[model samples]
Structures are given as C-alpha cells and as structure tokens.
Target: MQSCSSALCVLILLITTVTTSSGSASLSVTVKLNDSATLPCSERCSGLVTWTVSHKPTDVLAECDQTSCRSVKEGYQMIHDQYLKGNLSLTITDADFTKRDWYTCTCNNKDICDVALQLEPLRSSVQMKPGETLVLDLDVSDPVEVIYNSRANGSSGHICIVDRGSLECTVEYAQRASLTSALELKGVTPSDSGVYTIQVTRTEEVIHVYTVTIQDDLPHPDRDQETVVPVWGIILLILLVVLMGGCFCNVVVLQRRRNIMQRWRKTDGQRKKEKKKEKWLSLT
Candidate 1:
C-alpha cells in the first residue's frame, strides 16, 4: 500500500514540473535599431518581479517589487508609473543587435513569461537599368544570411549566407552575385523587375523580413533642354529691356529738336518786328 502511494506521488510531481516549465507564455517584439522596445509582464502581480536573460539565467536584467524598481542591465528599466498600476513591463532603450535574445520575466520569484526580441525589417526599393548591376543595401551589424526571392519570375533563392564575417554562396549565384557591405547582383535584366523579398537569417532562423521592389530605372531629365530654355528666357528679357531703352532715348531726342526749332522761329519773328519798327520811326 505504501509503495502504491509513493508511485502516485512521484507521478503527480512529474506532471507539475512539466506544467510549470512549459506553461510560461512567450511574447515576440520587433524593434528598430537605436529605438526602444518593451517586454510585457503581468499587470496583476503585486509582489516582486524579476527579469533575467533566459539563456543566462543568472544574469538579472531588471527587478521591480511592490514599492520600487531597479535595473541591473545598462539599457533596461521598468516604467515607474506603470509599475504603480501593476504593469511590470520592461523598456529597453537604444536597442541594437547585441540586445536580441530571449528574456524571462518572473513574478514573485516564479517564471511567468518569456520574450523574444527581434530587429525590425527595413523596406526599400531599387531601380536599375537593363544589363546594369543591382545593389541591395542591407545595413546589418550582426551575422546573417540573405535569401533573395522574386515574386514575378519565381526566382527564389538565397543570395549568400554570411556567418561571423565569412561568406558562402551557391555555385549558380557565385559568378553573378557577390557580397560586399551589401548584396550586389551583376548584369540584371528587365525580367528581374519584380517584388524581391529579403529574409535575414541567423542560425537558420529568420530574424528580419525585408521587402524590396525592383523596377526599371527612371529616365533622366533632359538637362540640356532645361538649361537652354532658361538661358533663352534671360536673353530675351535683356533684349526687350535694351529695345525699350532705345525707343525712350529716340523720343527724348525728337522732343528736344522740336523745341529748338520752335525757339529759333520765335527769335526770327521778333527780329522782323524790330526792323519794321525802326523803319517806321525813321520815316516819322
């Protein structure tokens, strides 16, 4: 009878342990570089709340009891006002690649939740001329593999896998595709214009999903026509100003000549009147 009781107790203990270990809920959060990210905890817990790095359980990230909050990590802190309202969410400022990891949140010294921090995907587009090279700018700081996919032509494959500063590529893409600070594809054609999806992987797990649209290059504006039009306009304006000035000078000169002729005629008439007066006075 005692053996049967012991066996039943052991079974119950095993069940409880499994339940506690797997029952903890997990939350995923995506944050941009240099931005702030929040890891949510329970809002109803009143006692002590502790956050730790999941892989390194001994590393405490932050802690908040009923009365106060403190941070053990450099960039992590608990919102004070939220803590007063029973929200024990942790905020990490200036998030970067080094901050991406699994974190555990425990309330009352019991593991209650887990958080997965991921980097936000960057979305952009690239324009390239036919038979020209295409560059996909991936401003990544950590090790990652880039999977390139085309939606229109169904040319979906990985461009390169970069791990710890080492790069490897498949045989088909080895000749045309290369990895510098970014992914570059040589001799792209019009058929390559489509929606390209970039999947950044770390340890075979996708950490970021970026969308890039490939399109034909925009036609360059006719710069010569633009320059010529403005130059002609300025030349016409200057010519119009000179013509107006010439017309004004001619009108002034004609007016002055007419005034001088009228003055000469008046003087001649006065001389004739004087001669007639002198002849009449001598006869009298």
Candidate 2:
C-alpha cells in the first residue's frame, strides 16, 4: 500500500511538470529591422533554437540558427547566428523591405515566439548603359546592400541583368557598409540601360529613380575636304590663267620643232636655207 501511494505521487508530479511546460510562449518584440533584432526566449529552454522570417505569413525571407536557410527557397536567406549576437534578434546586415516578415523563434522542447516587422522601402540610383561605368550617388542613414550577379531577392528592389552569372555586374557594384554604400561600374553597354533606384531605410524609407540613356559616338566628318572654293575666287582665276599659259607655250614649242625637223630633212642646201627661213617666219 505504501509503494502504491509513492507511485501515485510521482505520476502527479510528472503530470504537473508537463502541464506547466506546455504553451509557454514568450510575449515580446513588436518590430525588428536594420541591425540585430532580439526575440527573447526562455534561455534555460533555448536549445537548438531556430529563427525563421516570413512575409504576409507566406514567403520565408530569412532563417537563422541550426537549420536550412536556402537562397533557392523563394525570398529566403540564411543569416549567420554569430552576427545576431545571441539577442534572439535577427541581425539584418542590409535590412530591406523584401526581408520584412513575421519571424518565429522556436526553442528546442519549448513553445515558439514570433515578432512582426515591416522593413522600410529602399532603392538604387544611377541608371547606366550596358558596359558603361556607373558611379553610385546616394545618401542614407541605415545600412544598404548593392547586390549584383547573385540571385539576391529584396523586398524593395533588385538589379535585373540579361545573363545570370555575368561577373561584369558583380565587379561594378555590391559594397555594403553601416555609414555609406557606394558602387562604380566600368564601361557600361546598351544592355546595362535600365531604371536604377536608390533605396534608403531608416525609421522612414525612401527610394529614388533615375533614367539613363547612352548615345553612340559619331565619327567626325573630314573638315579639310568639306570646305568649298568659290568659282569666281582670285585663287581659282590664277590657276586658270596659269593652265592656259602652259598650253600656249606647249603649242609654240611644238611648231618650232616641226619646222627645224623639216629643214634638216631637206637634201638641197638652198631648200634647207629656205625651210630655216620659213621656220623663223612662223616663229615671228
């Protein structure tokens, strides 16, 4: 009978412990963004915890802690837990609207806790031609990420390219920082022409768009050949006179030679003398 009584007490204690631990979710955190955001959990029960982010309760934007965070998973990013600083807060290096969503924090053998967030709007500036260099012109309070070449999906905006794996765009942009974000491209081309938007996220979000157009370099016409000379100009008149004088001199020289040749061919001395006199007369 004493043994049965001890067994009943042990069963009751186990039942109470199970009931106390069930549905014990933490009620904390209204919004999170930019830097690391903490979602408080029962530290004692926080073993093998997982943090996941979803937009409109459908699209998972990012996941952190001991699980799969595939970039292939639509709008998903696996954040580094060390970056979070153990605040249970999601550390968004470059916080973006596309990343805004409901993040659920689950503790091993414990209830899940969640927080709602709205990432501010953001954009990129400097629309440029394909293969043309583009200098990033922007100012913002919050950190921003300039992504290219990778399959990076942001809630606010994205840079679209013709080819997926072209490293040209990668080398041109994608420098992230806390205070400033800038990028420069080398030799933009026609395919690079597009709507570039500048995205800034702080307490308030702002975006700016710029239209870019690249004109083809035109060949210059030959200036020396294009210049025209007037027909009645002094220079033209002088050229004509000189040409005529040359022709007249050629005619006179030809006639004198013919007469001299005829005189030499004459067999009689008297006839040759007569021919030479004719030649002199012709010249006179």
Q: Best TM-score goes to which candidate?
A: 1
Candidate 2 lowest-lDDT run of ten: 160-169
Question: lDDT per model, in order?
Answer: 0.76, 0.48
- Alpha-carbon error at 56 in model 1, in Å? 3.1
lDDT of 1 at 5: 100
Error of 2 at 226 (Å): 33
Candidate 2's C-alpha runs over 4 A off are: 1-42, 54-87, 120-284
For residue 73, what is the lDDT in candidate 2?
Answer: 49
Question: Please, what are the lDDT tens digits per residue for candidate 2 over residues 133-227?
Answer: 56654443344333332212322334422122221233233331111134455566654455555544232233334444444552223644457
TM-scores for every predicted model: 0.64, 0.25
